[model samples]
Target: MKDFVSVIITAYNRQKYLGYALNSVLNQTLDKDKFEIVVITNFEFNKPNYKNIIDIYDNQEYLGEKIYKGLHESKGDIICLLDDDDMYREDKLERVTSFFKTFYPIYYHNNFVTIDDKGNEIKIIEEYLKIPPYASFNLPEFTLAIENNRKTDIRNLLKLNVNFNSSSICVRREILENNAQYLRKIKAVIDSFIFYSSLLLEGNILLDPARLTYYRIHTLQTSSGNTKNIKEYKDSFSNLFKKAVEDFYIITEMLNGKINENILEIVNEELLRYKLLYKIFSGNNILIKTKFNIHLLNYYLLSLLPTFLGNLYIKDQYNRTKKVRSFQVKSSNIF
Candidate 1:
């Protein structure tokens, strides 16, 4: 029997374009005998054109849980994930199958695609990444990229970051089994977290240069999902910032003493970013009213304003960001 490659999709009420995603997998250049696709849904799957497909039902309110369950249930030698609204290239599985056949462990690839919503193509979100002058060789390049805050890497990946777009990754089954317990801890989009965790465990992650995937940019995306309404702005930013803080601590712990200097620099930047984000949320009157008491109100403002202003200064070090530059010029030069 040939080694099986599993393609898993986690979706909720995305009936409009789920077929595009399913067809993308079915059309893969990889042999049908060698791979299978699993669609995990909260609703019953009624589509008849699915191939080698299995439906795993998850009633959880969060999409992450559905993914977790499907990932756990899959028994293929290699595994990949696709979101409901996204589609993959015809050669996606072929590229991944070849990579895993050789590497057989932790590996991810670069992703190139456009974001489209409401039948219109939006601006391209591309990056020109350059590794810092002084980065430690202790960790792999992909891990370094994630740590150093470089979202894209034209050369070797120093760390796992945006370069490992979830749709573009494939991994060995052993990794999932070995890290089964840790997978439960993930609640939000878990790809980034899993990539970082794999690096911490294996000390190396391979990246193929082939951009063999299409991550559809749709209106129902997680980022723009519930925050489109003006009324949800403050709460959205607040919850987002709080989640950032929690992720920071988790990553710091994951890195342990193995922390590389380049990674630490990025962590400091992220901390500052969250601090600034919290401050911005505090300044919003709508968020302030959600809580009671003058003490709590003052507490929110006191913690937020200074850090928010500070993060703006840190972000100004890069290219021409007007918001950060203006904030830097107005604030005291205490850096």
Candidate 2:
């Protein structure tokens, strides 16, 4: 198992938690000689004692450039992302390598825990993964069929929650090499795009229930649980919705001209719903209604044909969001 994996850390000015992350990788159960740690960092701290650190720097203007620099510099058969603020359990490498050997999945994971800025333990992510919608749709059967035919299930998979946590995932190098050009094109949240694309295109996925990594949350971080003012919350939701739409379009285009009408209708309908919800939540009637494709308009009209359909939709959306936040709370206790 000599030089079997490459661990890439895209770090900025977060020095407080960097040591724990670096130590986690260095303390892995696998042989120290078997893996290399390539850190793409801008912060100039005393480097760790690890022998294999391949540190590089970027202009710091864009976060993605820092990650791109690291990804290009690293040379390993298997690649894993370890944010400077996150830590991996000692057994993470062992489990990841073992799982990858047996299952040729685009992505593999164990479990992830979140830690607050104060370093309090959070809950595990696996416990929060809502069981996919199954009653109304034969999703498992469809997934299996796609796998059997060696085709990508880009549509159905994206409709489900994003499963890959950047710090918890290990991907094959060939996949990265093949998608390098596409990866560079993405401007925001490159890890999410890469993980989603991999999961959509590659069928074999492994999920071990054991917690193996810690995702840190801090007030300075955009995606943390830090309390925000009304304006901040509005801005955050707006960004989230914009990214969701962008990801949807990207996935839809990637299906090689094979469009699934049912999924298209569902996604378009949901996007419009989300837009309307955002406007209402922000108490801003000035926001224009989202323009949707013909399929979405039909779905909207059909839903509204029944009395109080709009009210019910809003109520259900709130309830579902509550469930997701509840899951997030429960998941925050895992470290």
Q: Pick the candidate with the highest TM-score.
A: 2
TM-score of 1: 0.66
TM-score of each: 0.66, 0.68
Put down candidate 1 lDDT per residue, 218-311, tens digits, no spaces. Answer: 4335432222343353454456555545554555565556645555545444444454445555353322212233423433454545655633
Give candidate 1's error at residue 46 in angstroms: 2.1
lDDT of 2 by residue, 137-217 (tens): 111222121232134454454443334456766777765666665565444445455554564354665545666777665
**Candidate 2 regions off by >4 Å?**
1-3, 60-63, 123-164, 199-203, 224-228, 240-335
* Span of 10 residues, lowest total lDDT, candidate 1: 128-137
Model 2: worst 10 consecutive residues (lDDT sum): 129-138
RMSD to the true structure for each prediction, in A, is 11.1, 6.9
- Pairs that collide in candidate 2 are 122-332, 122-333, 122-334, 123-331, 123-332, 123-333, 123-334
Candidate 2, residue 12: Cα displacement in angstroms equals 3.0
Candidate 1: Cα lDDT at 282: 39
Alpha-carbon error at 101 in model 2, in Å? 1.3
